[model samples]
Target: MKRILLFSLLLPLSVSSQSNDKMCETLSKINALVKENHFQPKPVDDSLSVFVFDKFIDGLDENRNIFTKSEYEKLSKHRLLIDNYIAKNDCSFMNDFVSIYKKALERKKSVLEKLETVSLDYNSQDSVKFSKDQFPFDLTENDFDRVWKKRLRFDILEDISKLSKNADSLQLHFTEIEKTIKQRVFDTNLCKVNSILNNKNGVKSILKNDFLNAFCYYFDPHSNYFSFDAKSSFLSGLSTSNLSLGIEVSMNERDEIVIEEIVPGGPAARNSKIEVGDVVTKVSNTKGEEYWVSCSSMETIGEMIFSDHNKQIELTLRKKNGTTIAVLLKKKVMKATANAVYSFIAEKDAKVGYIKIPNFYADFDERSPKGCADDVAKEIAKLKKDNISGLVIDLQNNGGGSMAEAIKLAGMFVNAGPISVLVDNNHNQNIINDFFRGEIYDGPIVILMNGYSASASEFFAAALQDYNRAVIVGSTSLGKASMQTIMPLEENNENDFVKLTIEKFYRISGESHQIKGIIPDVFAPVLFDSLIKRENSFKTALPYNAITTSTKYNPLPKNITSEIINLSKTRIDNDLRFKELKSINEEINFTYNKPRNPVRLTFTDVFKEVHDIDSLWEKVKNATEKENSLLIYNTSYDTKKLASDDFQREINTFKLKDIKSNPYLEEAINIINDYKKFKQ
Candidate 1:
């Protein structure tokens, strides 16, 4: 995962006051540390410099829409000089690049401002194509302006189509969308100017951070630099002192800052005024002085709202229904229970237990006393008391945390045995084993996983699968099996740290789940499989390797795996819900992967396209709901008493809905039931 940097509300104190001496001092320290402690250190040669140069440029202009070809050529002189510059602690190349970028931004801003005043015919047969790969930079000013105009037009057309269905209404919505586009562009430009280009200190810091990160990532994808603000946020997340309004925010494709999830018991959840998909337009202080926080990164928003605990902040949000509202929330210590282990009994032919492990969260600080391993153990004990014949541990979307917790958690299902092997760069192997003498439940266990299940989660699932203690089901897990250790540069300063990948993990079966994650024994239809993000997708990711281990574990009964797979295939073939899920997955894959031809600029064409897309998603939702109905399970919680607290009531309602609608959980329960029958 990318490290998020928290920003301060304070503007840059001095725009051109960065000292070369300070820059050199910081660079010297980083270079020395990288050489000494980096897992796979590389020599600071010309080849390394070229890699760093390209990475830095990509970080600056990711879309390749800024600096022209001529500008790039001008900076090519420093492509092979980065090593020398680093050795000498010089930043002359960075200064030159920043100067060129600022000028290009100014020119683009001027073009956007002028274009916003003119009206273009929406009936024309004009269209634009978008791609992730970098394109040739426009050589002439006219070419640059043309590229931006087409992009702006495409954005406006897309937004208008979403708002209006007919030609007449499209025109009205287009006008409104044009105004919004102009304002957003202007606001973004101003922010860049003030925070980056205009501020020498900010520019210097960014250049240093980017350059160091490029150097680190040249070794592998996981190792990178952490700025002061970023390090602070990372630490805070691991500790109980982390304070927030309790909302997960993400930037949508339309550049809108959307509320993705509301943390239970958080201020937003307590207020019940915000919903997922709400676009946050503005943020205000207690005095009602508002700032344009729309379309900003989550880190920037976190910095603005999380400055003080118990302080009130107001947000102006636009909902999916096109209604706008103001919500005031007091920032406080978010409840730890939000990430705690949660379980419920799924009653079918026989009672079965289901536990959802969000992550292997554990506080490294011994005094914290809160750990996921203990929580999961307790949940397992409770489920055993309920006399569940089978158990399903859902590890979906679990991007993993502590390795210690993973080993301990695996111990709950099996007696003492080797769980995994840790291989360091020196070719030394350390076997991580389970010391527990007794199993907690020892019943039929099914471990549910997805593409997002990574690191520690993979370790736990792989261990259980190795021991034949649990049947791994769902999509292949996220291929992230490397361990990272945070190494602080300055002994006295906690703000400067580098997360370096120090070791790789291999299962007791002698296979490393590095780039090739654990493959499920039974596969199900997963929507957005192509869109699922994973570490192996990166070109710079470390290659998968395996080391021989002497440890051995008990395997499943002969023919059991084949029997269960055959049974699952037969059941899924006749299952209407599974058929619908497959259909939904195919539609989604087709829609997203379809070719992008020239779209007629006419309102009718755009409206039809938008409507078709919306209809396809509606079918997917309906199919999902139908699948969820099969998993409906009864709960014993007293909702009437919980209804007194709005947040708790909402949480209970969500839990009930999830239990009813979870198709994956339902399948796991069915599989466990099959295993029970086989044992009989």
Candidate 2:
């Protein structure tokens, strides 16, 4: 019977509409492209079919909130037929899966609406496990009811906790919490329903992408399918003319839209009232039209924000200190600088220069004269003129950019050497060497990196580390050694693009930093290091493998690594701020790794959770204060006195504050100082 079903899958699929034909064509193209171009393409067999099926389902319902166990089983019947369908250009399975998912969403929405109408018993001793892993799929209505009830209770409890914290010991009754939960549920459901109903095209696009991406994942996690709209967005993001409010926003655990970053010189940065961590409660237009944006997804909020440009939008933000403020900001084209190199000098015992390369950004079109390599070279020249004793290159959180720029940047440090080895699909290796003669500043060097430093960033750091030219500091790097190239599938269709993993990068030492990232010689405490995601965390990520390289480089001084490690460890252990951060990280790890167990649904229990979180925040605040106190700005290069405009003043103040609060930078300075001492 299974063979018969597979045979039927090979038959020509019924031509329902133009959309179906287009989807089939796209899928066919993707299959051909992956097989031809992917670094590690899997055979389109039953095994791959199963993998694709599972990936597609998971992509649709990642939290396992919508689909029931029986529904999943129903869809599992076509698992072995996916490969045959793709080969025959049949999208019947894809259509069926999408239909099922849409129905499931509707059913789930109805269930939630019904739940809101019914009163939940808060005094009940029954408790629900909070972890999704505990019950990934529900078997029955009762199980879903239990899950939803528990989730609603938790949400209510969290809100009450926040309220209690603000009210200063004003205990909230169970009735009050229930009332808040009811209102929140209604609001959230309304938004969800409205979003679904209003954005049919968006929903269709997402489903199509999910279906295609599941097949793409058979190659690797990095290989992805970019739809027409997604391709446009991706390209626009890299373009210089991309317009926005200039604030990076994220949806916090509590569904609050929080400002994660205020882009320097952007409208949000210009508006002194707006700050990071500020919760956006409401957004309104100048015409008194208010948008209840709280609890909305980032996409929804973004659409509302980007609906009209050059318009004054009033934002109601709740500050971290629990104060509410409304700020009117006019949307304007952000005048962001293309320069990626930011430098400053440490005025301590010996003047040490610090250069932060956020990313190896470059204009591939060559429209601009300034690239990451050029900017870094300029900064190095400036630091050299200042007669700095040592230099610290900071790549902490640099996710990398242009490979060419990384090569050029690495060349600036080394006169001429092989930066990295690129391995193609056929296992052919190509040595990317820097032929440039003479180093920029061959002084004692230290490179700072964290979990977020990846790709080109890793290449630059690894090159320097391999040559023993720089002492690497901070947590492990992001371990993304694979190189991706975006291949346009259909020339006529702009949206048909495949970002295929075409090659893997290896260090000059013939070491691959694929899953195993570069380890810092002088390790510094990175808050939530374990929680940060890396290439190794992905199940489908490429394995760490190395290739033989014919590159020879100068090695660092013997015992330098051990000496720096010992000195840094001693300082880190003695530092109270570092101790607090370590303690906090330990607590967080414990919380994250702890097994999910049901606890009594009580106000005390909720309060305890809230209290614990609050205590953690308190520790973080104290640690930040201690670290900030130790920050010594380069008074010689103080831009505050030279600032003639509001933009410069705002940016300078932000930069100064950032520098003061940077513990990693301080450690880097110390590491460079240690290098100087050891050399002497």
Candidate 3:
């Protein structure tokens, strides 16, 4: 039967009018392109079919809130048939899946509505597990009712915990507060359902896109299918500046859009009322079109804010103290440096220069090109002027950007040589060499990285590590080494695009750190290392492989490296704050990795759970921010450069304080100090 099904899958699909023609064509095109050009493409067989089927379902009902066990079982029959369906260019299966999911959403909505009138028992000893992984899906509609009611009660209890932290200040009775909280929860859930479905046409469109994305994921995590608009957005986000409010937002557990970070020197950073953790309640575009965030999809709100069509926007933010304020913001050209490199001189035993590259952004404006590589070079020049003995390049949390920029940055450290090797799908090798002849700053150097450092960051780090130039510190880096290029499906049109993985790169040492990331020379425990989902975590990630590659470059003497690493480790062990940080990381690892117990629904028990989690992180925050022995200062060159801009100056002020308090930076400084001593 399996052999017969495989033979049938190879046949040309019969076009069905019931299915979307564009979607069918897209899947077919993506299928052909991946098989032809992807770094490593898996055959469309039962294995691929099962992966896509499970992923699509998981994407829709991640928390197991929508689909019941019975519904899932009914859908599981199609698990092995996705390969056949895709091969035939048929999207009818998507329609069925969406229909079932739609019905499940409606059922959930009905339960939410029923929950509003029903009073929950606050003192009940019943326990509910918060994570979906900790429990199973409901067996029936009756089971859904019991599960959803518990979920509603849990949400209400959490809200009450937050609202009544200062019960005396609220001055509201418990009964009235409970009623208000219940109504709010019901309204939010209803809005989430309405926004997802939108109307008759929207449900199909949203699910169709989800299906397409899931189909693409089976090839590799880097390979993705993108609509014209999404493709444009993806390209623009790669080291490009956009006109915006300069604030980043993320959805919290309650589905509320909370401000995550305000970009330094951006419009939002200047607003005193707008703060991180402030909930965005509403947004209005330049056309005076208002969108209630609770009733709208985050994508819609994000488009309104980040889209070039809107030159101005007004955001209604709800503060922690329950006060609401609306701030009008005009679009400004936020430079790449707003989130790029910032240099400081750490004065401990010596003047150690510090430079952090959060991303390797490129100059999108060809006419006036000022890329991350150039920015780092400028900072290095300033640090050189400060007469620093050694330098620490912090690449922690850098998810990477332009490959060209990464190569250029690597050039600043080493002499002209073949820095990296890229192998295409056909096994054609291409050597990426740095053409620049001389080094900018060749002093004793330490590069700090964590699991979040990926792609171009890994490329740069790998080059330096292989050359034996920079001592790599911190945890293992994110192991992505593949390169992707965007291609339009149709000629002379910008309708559909696929960002396909074209090549996988290898370090100059001929080692390919694809799934397993770059292991640091000196082991330093990063506080959030375990929480990071590395490349190996992905089920379909490309396997690690190597090629015979040769590159000639002079390396720093390797004789004293072991001694330096040992000294740094001894310092970390002896330091009181460092010991505390290590202990906190262990506790964090346990808390995050351990099987969670069922949470008690009562306010007291819920509050305790909330407090314990918060306290665990609070300890980490305090340890990292503890006053260190290093005296950090901005360079004169940077001071003069920022003298003309008040916004940049203010940002620099905050960064200086942050750098002084960073334990990791302190440790990296110590390592560099050791390197300098060993070199002497």
Report lDDT (CA) for all predictions.
0.73, 0.74, 0.79
Clashing pairs in 2: 228-495
Best by lDDT: 3
- For candidate 2, lDDT tens digit of each residue in 45-113? 999888888777876677677788888888888989987887787776666676777777777777777
- Writing each residue's lDDT as its tens digit, candidate 1 over 1-680 gives 12322222222323232444565666677677767665556788898888888888887777677788888888888999988988877765667776787787777767767776677666676776655456665566567667776666665566566654465765666667767755665565556545555554456666767777887888778887776664345335433336678777655534466886677667787776787769987787776456666434445555566666438889888765444578988877764454467777787778888888878988788887578888877777777776789888989878799998998888877788888888876767898878878888778888888898899999999998888888887889889888888888778867677788888888898898888998888887776676786778876787887777888777656477568767876787777877877887887888777775666766666666666676666676576565353433323443334556665565655666656767777778788888888878
Kindly give the stretch of ten consecutive residues in candidate 2 with the minimal lDDT sum.
Answer: 230-239
Measured on C-alpha atoms, candidate 2 has an lDDT of 0.74
After TM-score superposition, the amount by which residue 608's alpha carbon in candidate 3 deviates from its true location, in angstroms, is: 2.4
- Which segments of model 2 are wrong by more than 4 Å? 1-19, 132-138, 141-150, 166-181, 202-205, 230-244, 249-260, 265-300, 307-334, 556-562, 599-604, 628-646
Residues 504-582 of candidate 3 have per-residue lDDT tens digits of 9998878898987988987776776887889998887888988887666666678787788888888877878767867
Angstrom error of the Cα, residue 107, model 1: value is 2.6
What is the Cα root-mean-square deviation between model 3 and the actual structure?
6.3
Which lDDT value does model 1 have at 584? 79
Kindly report which residue stretches of model 1 are placed more than 4 angstroms away from their true locations once superposed.
Answer: 1-28, 42-47, 87-90, 113-126, 164-168, 172-181, 230-245, 249-260, 265-290, 294-300, 303-339, 556-558, 600-612, 627-650
Error of 2 at 470 (Å): 0.2
